[model samples]
Target: MEIAGTLRTAREMGLVACTSCTRVWPAGTERCGRCGHRLHTRAPLALQRVWAWWLVGVIAYVPANLYPMLSTRTLVASQEATIIGGAVDLARHGNWGIALVILTASVAIPLGKFLAIAMLALGVRHGSALTGSRRQQLYQVVEYIGRWSMIDVFVVAILASLVQLGAVASVSPGPASLFFALSVIFTMLSAQSFDSRLIWDAEREGRRA
Candidate 1:
């Protein structure tokens, strides 16, 4: 009954897990043998760093949406297209499927990452309706899918590189390309800064309260 009366976390049990190598070690071990990353039960000042990066991500994302993502120069004239504008043009040209893909990758994924990171950060501070396991799963999903958000950047790069014809026609990345890349980078850093142990800690605290 005593054993069943309470649960213990990895930290409470004197275990620390390595983030890089996923190796488990007894607490107080200085580094992981497999990966050499310093062992700690939870990341120090996790929320502060998460918020800082998140703020950067949000700021960069604003410009990513407002500015032109790509510019095209032809024998006739020059044209610039924002992310939404590019998608709309694609749709107008009867490429609805590709437009939808672009919209989902560029807009939906970035916003989803921001919301998921914010929710995880907030959930640690205040209890959430989502179970700890569920939120952890969300965190993993956000982390895994983060790199794909750069699809728009890749598209722009490919177009710019392939379309250059030395006065005939050319495509070039716009200012938004840099901002979009930065937004994705910062958001990914924000997500990585989070300490997943805090999710279970919150759950335990809620149970106790």
Candidate 2:
């Protein structure tokens, strides 16, 4: 029961296959009925689809950094803070842990995911023989870390809900939240769009007599 290409496009369309018995199953199934093996499925997207969304995320990233991500109001005064400002606030107040979390989740992780995705997309497009394996690893890492970018959004939501003190003090999500979310989503899509089969295809082509 080895995983095979039959499950790739099929799984992308909501089908899956058991890795132990090579049995096909619907996407919702947790295990193969015949062999009770874990299933594997390809994520939707071929290559172009992933690249398109990746590009969108990259484009959105600029505005995500430029615009404010959190706003505060207290005593009839309003203040908006960009990503850097938020980090600075945390650092200045000695909340180093929170500051690091915000920095990594909001700034470093998303950018790293985007750059890695873009590199994978470009590598796949060019069918570069020199670095295919490296690109694949990058793709996997981008996919795995993509969801963590939502931490900032979660924090914003929590603060917004808990800090509602009428005119005394309040916290609100800023425009950058939407952009940052879009950035994360697009990079995830980009990672999904990449087809690992492309590497295999090139390898096969190389081996053909």
Candidate 3:
């Protein structure tokens, strides 16, 4: 059975299996509510369509770092903090816990997710058999952890709203907010664009006689 454009195969009959019930069903069935899956004969957009979004996310990640993410004003003095600066400020204030949180959520996680997606995209594009399962595992990790990267964004928004003062102090989001948001959004799109079925397909092809 097929759902979301993926095909499932039956072990015994060696034919496409119903995604919902695990029973063998003839092709072109409109619905299979038993297993709650759809049957589709054709594969979705080929691998390239998936890779394109990954490529865009990789490109956007660069600028997301170079720009300042937040601006602060206190006593008529203004300062801006890039992603690294925010982490440094937390460290300076002896807020090690928040510092580490910011570092992992903003820096390490985003980079890791991007690299993982890039590796997955590259492996699929070149049909690389080198540790396909590992690549797939990396893809799953990226997809699952993608939402955590929003922690920094939420922190920024919350602080900006809470620290507003007529003249004594204020906080505002900066250009990096847009870039950082785009970074998260595109990376998520990158993860979603990947086809996990390709990993299984490659594995099955390897075992085929």
Whole-structure CA lDDT of model 1: 0.93
Write candidate 3's Cα lDDT for 45-134 as tens digits.
635655677667667777767888889999958999999898899899999998898889988998888677766766765666567678
**Which ten-residue region of model 2 has the weakest summed lDDT?**
4-13
lDDT of each: 0.93, 0.77, 0.74
**Model 1 weakest lDDT span, ten residues long:** 1-10
Q: What is the TM-score of each candidate against the true structure?
A: 0.91, 0.73, 0.78
Better of 1 and 2 by TM-score: 1
Residue 132, candidate 3: C-alpha displacement in angstroms? 4.8
Candidate 3 lDDT: 0.74
Candidate 2 lDDT at 103 equals 93
Cα lDDT, model 2, residue 197: 58
Distance (Å) between predicted and true CA of 182, model 3? Answer: 1.3
Query: What is the per-residue lDDT of model 2 for residues 1-209, given as tens digits with 9 covering 90 to 100?
Result: 87655533454557776656767788878778898875556434566687788789899988988999989999978999998799999899999998998898888898788767666656655656455566567667777889989888788889999999999999999999899888878877777767675655554455564
Better of 1 and 3 by lDDT: 1
Which pairs clash inside model 3?
1-17, 1-19, 20-35, 21-35
Name the best candidate (by TM-score).
1
